[model samples]
Target: MSASPGQNLFRQPRAVFAVAFACVVSFMGIGLVDPILPALATNLNATPSQVSLLFTSYLLVTAVAMLFTGWIASRIGAKATLITGLAFIVVFAALAGLSGSIDGIVGFRAGWGLGNAMFIATSLAVIVASATGGFAGAIVLYEAALGLGIAAGPLIGGLLGDISWRGPFFGVAVLMAIALLATVVLVEPLPKPAVPTPLSAPIKALRHRSLLTMGVTALLYNWGFFTMLGYAPYPMELDATQLGFVFFAWGLLLAFFSITGAPWLQRKFGTAPSLYGALSLFAVLILIIGLFTGNRWTVIVCVIASGVVAGINNTLTTQAVMLVSPVERPVASAAYGFVRFIGGGLAPYAAGKMVDHWNMHVPFVVGAVAVLIGVAVLTTGHRPLAAADAAMAAGDRHTDPDEVAGEVADEFGGAPDAIDFEKELDHR
Candidate 1:
């Protein structure tokens, strides 16, 4: 039997905790700038479009670099990748903090994205390889880390950003430095892949229909996701601290739903229906925000409420991609990351430009329509998704155990039988 989520969360090896801790600080980078967007614009004498490039540069570079992570890991090994990524984040985050110009900070943030892609791409494999519970437990732990980091990032940023816009950047550098040290001391080195992954693997994975479908769906969904994440703060017009609290609430819901609520939802509605329902609701919410951009309370409520759907989508979409794809898990993940991050990276900058050229309401309107189109795109793969769901229901599923094993080869390098593939399959 699978362990409960609570048990999975706490009953883990020291190495798991070390990587999970680092995962939390790594995810914090996602929302660290939420409360500071306004301050960044004012202090740097930049327009919202220029300030929005922070997200664009960071995520864009991260997206492009994801294609190479598996290749790098296969050659150098996971521990080296993790440490290298962490080192880059510590240096780049500090450089961003110390930057005198918005353009300079933007450049540094791009560097931070490179490090982030390497860390995030490898962290899951390490968690899966090292965690005590089965693969299910490791996934829950990873998602929990994601939730906590995302939720806390804005709060931390708010508290520090209230002092200075640069405070959050420096704070991340300090925290990441600590995480880097913990990783070095606690986690053992992992084995490199017997055959190094090709640079073209992730791109090749995209040729499969189901993988391509989900990737496109994710891309469209991200258009809505980042539009809200990047632009909604401006419409609400809250100060740094106030914006922090608001997004903290949003992230809290997101974290809670991702860890607990998503499974319940999947159990009740199944994956595809749940996704469609959530996407529909998300579209309605974005439309509502666009309709009522002038109303602060309404916009705030919508922003927070959107997290529920976002959380559900995050968990389900990831599962769907894993279940439906035929490629190795690492390649599938890298491919999905490549496509979705491009959309995520671009949306914020587009929203900022839209606001500059069009109006405040236009971005949300575009976001809503894009989300609906994502729902439509998902329909093309319904038959395959249904097959995946049926396979999952029968307790007979398959994932890339070799890839996961490669991720933490040092811990289980000589003990291939240590991983229970059947239990891991069921858990997903």
Candidate 2:
């Protein structure tokens, strides 16, 4: 028997693998600082809350800059954009390593964030444009990078941070430079969008009801996601190496589920129901973490369990947004990114302040509540979301992840009725 699309996960072209490898290294930056958070505070004479600015500066810049990544990529071409982004990361990460003050590191991290935003937004389009197996397979590949990076980041950071707080920063610079080289050598040049993406396009995409609804939902979801990442570590009181192990365990489960559990759950439950369940469960986990902030073991277990929820949500929402939005995929991506990253950026900063002014429980409670609010926000788009489900079920489309389609084939899983995005680009 021929292999199912699900079984054909690893059989990708070199370009896909190259970009995916770069993706893994790029995403590692997200969690690279986790194990080092405490170390920075102690070494730099900063408070835990001030150290939290690292996430804030990075994500806030990413949020704002990602809005224009597509526009920039369209003008410069994808390969150049990816290389530029990688170059920015390499420079800023090294600068951050050399910085003396918390404020200096925070500012350099903002530069790193801009690079990350450009790289991520462009890479997703490139991966989908080149991937094999199927649309679903491509997204799984992308998310796999995210999961692997998340899993490895803290462990590497922890190991490096043990030597010095500056270690992870230097490590990121080296790894990113290698990724830049691989991308240059291995990936073929991708065709730019025929018409340049206007600066106003992504913002205008928000006018679509489905896109807006999903964006708001993601905004709320990220509030919970980043809060866990930014503030949860403070309560654990583990050293850098121990913290790395805990998050490594968490990332392992996250990666495993991002590949296996999410697709299976979406298959059995459909996107909306699976998303509802995952968000609900994650909210409960955050609540548990909040209620037992003093119990290190309890907090650790809940954080690990959250990986499953994060994985499921990451895959499903990605497909759902692609499927439901009426706008072009790149536009939808940029707009969605703009909303979600803003929330992702601010949540941790807020969490730090909340902890200072209130109790540890306060931040977790807010995170849990934010997730619940996301679930509610998602409900408003039920009809369109249901339409997307119908579109997926129309063919043998239930198995794959994302499709790099345009306006004509808005649904993922590559239904027969949909137009091929690459072919469309070729014709144009």
Candidate 3:
């Protein structure tokens, strides 16, 4: 069948913009809070480790919560979940603004993380379902927005922190409210997913060799990413404004790569090659930063290089998973996100201990090794999605007509009471 005209534009442009805008707002909140961590620690008379919990706790919950969000959205509908999640962020951000102590802030951050989990899971699914063409551009756009948000967080957070540590939290509350409104006014409800696979189904998919390996790869990268992003400025003894500049540079490099480099790299090199290359480069960059810590120029160069690597590597890794199982993209995204968070949660605490017992450089070395391992994991025996796509096409060409028909029916919401997947599996 011929594809519908203008379908590509209709599916992605509108919904993707809305989702990206929502992410921008929520991520801005996250970014804004980051630069204020030290101030908050001092203000609350808490240890640096305790204040760092602000990032760790939020990510931890969001990571765990994301695993279930896909199934929940399928049951409740994406629009409802999106709206409700934004509400959590908006309300809790305000609550965070009111916090007078470290514990209060940590609690609020965790609550906001729950909202983020909902937003991330629902937004991702909606974007994929709403997108018409292949997902390379769409994924890049999503990652770009994320990078922009991360970049903006420190700058804005620094500005607000200059006034008061409480200031950024208040701004976060306001931005989230604005995003909530935008989502309602600009974004349309996504078509409900046709087949709501059981939670067990995703678990089963995870057992697939490729999926399991990618999950581990994602976890290790997240551990490295959160470690680097979370701690890059701490040992430099930089003020908030200086740190903000560094973050801005980092985000700018990421956005540049996300917007420009990603498409070209994916197109020229193919997803797996681009992904593996990016991973290798990122590992090297992290090590460079750690090893040359005393050389200011080299450190700055390494930071920018790291941003480029992160943008390309992350986008391609996600693309790899989606290529293999387009239908399971949401579940896979959530599962990968969950693993990433588990890794993220562990990194800070582990790195914090190292910072206490050894030296700050210790975490950087560990993080570098972790990224290298991720590269190996992602590249080892990795059957590229292109190969998978080709094999499927060949399979379709060779398969019996009845089998193909049944596969189509099963995939796209077959006629009510018309097909049994169990029967089809038995036939296979």
Candidate 4:
């Protein structure tokens, strides 16, 4: 008898939910703090730039933590790391809620960021490990959940922040507890044990030219993306519900496309062209957003339009980055995550400074420039990644982990200390 068509998806539904809730919880903590920045500044008797550090503090720790969490995931196992991270998050969030002073919140925010680093880094690796056909479907699912989490953050945060600045953090802490329990009980352990690769391997991979470019691309995209998100509502004087609607549209659009639009585009244009097109359109969308500010209908339309491009851009960029270093995907992803978060970390400071010194639109202009820079990098450094992916794909036998490992080792050349081909080969 034939198996059900969607069996693979259900195979690890519980694990998926655990990770998805983690995504939602971590992001809720972030968004909850965001809308209240102005309030936080007033309450704490701080400058806007100082209040913005709440974001910078969290993202900075998360970025630094990502550098090692991927290595830790390999050693401890993805599932275990995920549970630990969520527990840390739950504890830290509750502490953050109880903070009596700005310095207290900053300290707890850094701790929260550290927990985020653990959660996000392991979450991606776990998804990839759980999937049947590598990360193809898993990426889409991850992105969809990411969109939902990001989309919900503003509305939920706004509501809670209005009631009390501390309310959102407490509410998110409650969510984190539930997530922690789900992560502990619901997710199945990996069938195969996680193979430990040496720490030096990831360090070496980070030095690769292709991976460096990918990191740069990620940083630029995030700089632009977060700048837009971090400061958009404030300049326009949007209420919490309106901000929620914007995020809702953003999530809904990405969910629709990730499930549908991306596949069709990939089928038609192939990865490279689709990638370039998505990046190009992303740049244009940034311009459109800057141009159409203050009109609710236009803002909603532009925000939603940007989601399709973002969904496609993320999936394709991840694929492109992975293609260049198939064996080192986890490490590469961590590096990319680090770069993206670094950019994200600085965004609030940069955008807030801009809004404080110049005007709100200044940040959007700067964001547009950042997106354009990413497009330029992607367009310029097109060859190495493409050539590498083609070389590996030629020898890789689809769905065969052994063949995939062999192909990757051969393409990247055998580096025992760097790759530990034996470890990868055995995992197959």
Candidate 5:
């Protein structure tokens, strides 16, 4: 039997570490430029709307690319897909550093998004395939990696953006290059799937009402999430270094809660109440940020505290999405990824436009309203969520090792030997 999550979480092979390291660096790209948003706006003589395009370009591209990343991974093999994605990040990030204009940086960020999608598409599967821990253990480690990368990104970005806005961009290029080398050396080649994932699979997966309801809910909540991520920095008026520390605290809280607090809350409150509470809390936080836009301390506090709430919501919502669907974890994950990212990508630019036309409070209040609507959207699929909970309590999960191995290999890409994966996932 696999050890406890705490014990096995750190007891992984070097290959797991290698991919986990790459996962960290890859996720860092999500917030790597956050501290620099204001700096880039000022230095480049661009408007907040233009600077917001940095997020728009990156996330929108990632959103669309989610649809195809599985197809790419299935055909090319996992290691190749991971390497290809890493290579793309290394190139685009460096090019972004070299660019002279805001438009150029924004364009390069779009390219970086493509790489980000590729890496995300395969990294979790690689970890699952190679982890010494079983599936649950692998998730703990994966989520931990996610936390560290997210928490560290801003501190690193802050320190570098303290030097120059280009510093964060170049920093990622160098770090991802190191990660790329590690993957090439440590990770063994994975076999291609016997049945390749169709490009249209994720698109079709959304036809299910449970999946679509959850997807729309995710999208709306993300509107609030990214609105804060994209625009709140401007109102704070802090320099890059201070902004870094502020968001570092935020990321730290997010990471901590994702691993510990979220699970505890879910266990105690159950999924629906936990999600509703977290979502309501997050909306209130966004509304607070809007009401207190002129108060830097208020913005800073709400921004940091929102991390706790967001972490809870992130974990629960993800679980709910998987549980509520009849589809495999990956298809559901990809479908969810696509919709949520679209909301995340567009909110920043739209927030900026709203601010320029009306005021700061409008975008955030609107964002909070969007989240409240998400709470309503979530209600539409209450039966599915409850049934999922029932399924889990009855221990009705698939447990046959051969069945799991085949499913893992089929969804994540693997050779025939993957039938021996031995990692029976109770949950994705």
Candidate 6:
């Protein structure tokens, strides 16, 4: 019999734990710099727009690098990709800490993004392949690590930023190095893809209706997500520690909802209704923040509240993309990552520029509208998402094809069974 989800969580292998630990640290990089943005501006003698480019550079590189992740992984294999990505992050994060100027830090961050793309794209596939209790269990574990990382990032940033603006960067370097060591030691190497994925694969994957639909929706959703994440710190005008605590609260709600709340909601309301309600609620929250940008208490409350919906959206949207797409999981992830990261990368810089020129309120107002646009985009994918939901309900989710093929090859001590391969690929 299949293991229960609760039991599956504990039954994971050492390799799973190693990679999951790395996932937690990798995700922390997303929010690790939040507590230090204001500090960076002060110490580096930069404007908000300049500091915001830190995100722009990092995400832009990550977005572009995602296109090649599938190609590289298919050639070099998963373990090499994971280690290379981690090494890049460790080196660049430390370099970012050592930089003397904002421009220097931004340059290093871009390098960090390239590594991030490789790691993020491959890590999901790894977890999906390695975890037990089926796809749902793996997703829960992945989302949980994401939550913990996101939640801890700002707290770590806050504590360290109290020492210096550079402290958080160095902290990520140290922690990620440890994660890299764990991954190298614990995670067993996997066989290379039997058929190499072309470099054009991720780009081609976007032609699929379900992948494109979810990718575009995530693009729109990210505009709102990053607008709040990138700019909210400025309006609050709190010190590093206070800003850390506030976002820590936000990240906690994000973590809780992602791991526990999202699955519950998906089972109860189904994917479509759950996403619609959550995105709508999130758009409204953004509107409130826009309307009350000048009110510190109101901004803080709205920012924290946004986490609940954001958390739900994060988990549900990821699950939706994986389920609905017909492409290999890694390719789907890369294609989806390419679109959303572009939006995520662009939004913060845009928000910063908007704040620089127009007003703080304008960015949030625009963000609210963008999120509502995501709601509309999601509507276009109703058919595919419905089918995916039905598959989940029927316990018919597809396993990772590369993993299935590897297992078949091991069992037969030669080429995989073509029938078995086709069955796994077409399972959904």
Give the CA lDDT, 0 to 100, for residue 366 in model 5. Answer: 92
Ranking 1 against 5 by TM-score, winner: 1
Residue 35's lDDT in candidate 5: 95
Q: Give per-residue CA lDDT, model 1, range 1-428, as digits (tens).
A: 13444463577888899999999999999999999999999999999889889999999999999999989988898899999999999999999999999999999999999999999888988887888666555666788788889888999999999999999999999999999999999999876655677888788767666778899999999999888888888879989999999999998898888878777877777778888999999999999999999999999999899889888888778777766655556666788899999998999999988898999899999999999999999988776666655555454222343333322222222222433333433433
Residues 1-428 of candidate 3 have per-residue lDDT tens digits of: 11134444334566567778887777775557656766776788987677767778888988888877878777777888899899999888888889888888889988999999888877766765555543444566677677788778888888878788888888877887887887888778765556664665455545445556677887888777777766665655566676677777777787778666866786676666777788778877778767876676676667757888777776666656655532355666777677777787778767778778987687878988998798788775355444543343456322232343334334433423422444434432
- TM-score: the better of candidates 1 and 6: 6
Whole-model lDDT for model 6 versus the true structure?
0.86
Clashes of each: 0, 2, 2, 0, 0, 0
lDDT of 1 at 255: 83
Candidate 5 stretches with Cα past 4 Å from truth are 1-7, 396-428
Scored by CA lDDT, what does every candidate get? 0.83, 0.83, 0.70, 0.69, 0.81, 0.86
Backbone-clash count (model 4): 0
Whole-model alpha-carbon lDDT for candidate 1:
0.83
User: Model 1 TM-score?
Assistant: 0.91
Two-way lDDT contest, 1 vs 6, winner? 6
Highest lDDT: give the candidate number.
6
Off by over 4 Å in 2: 1-7, 398-428
Worst 10 residues of 4 by lDDT: 396-405
Q: Which regions in candidate 3 have their CA more than 4 angstroms from the true location?
A: 1-13, 132-134, 294-298, 386-428
Every model's TM-score: 0.91, 0.92, 0.85, 0.85, 0.90, 0.92
Candidate 2 backbone overlaps, count:
2
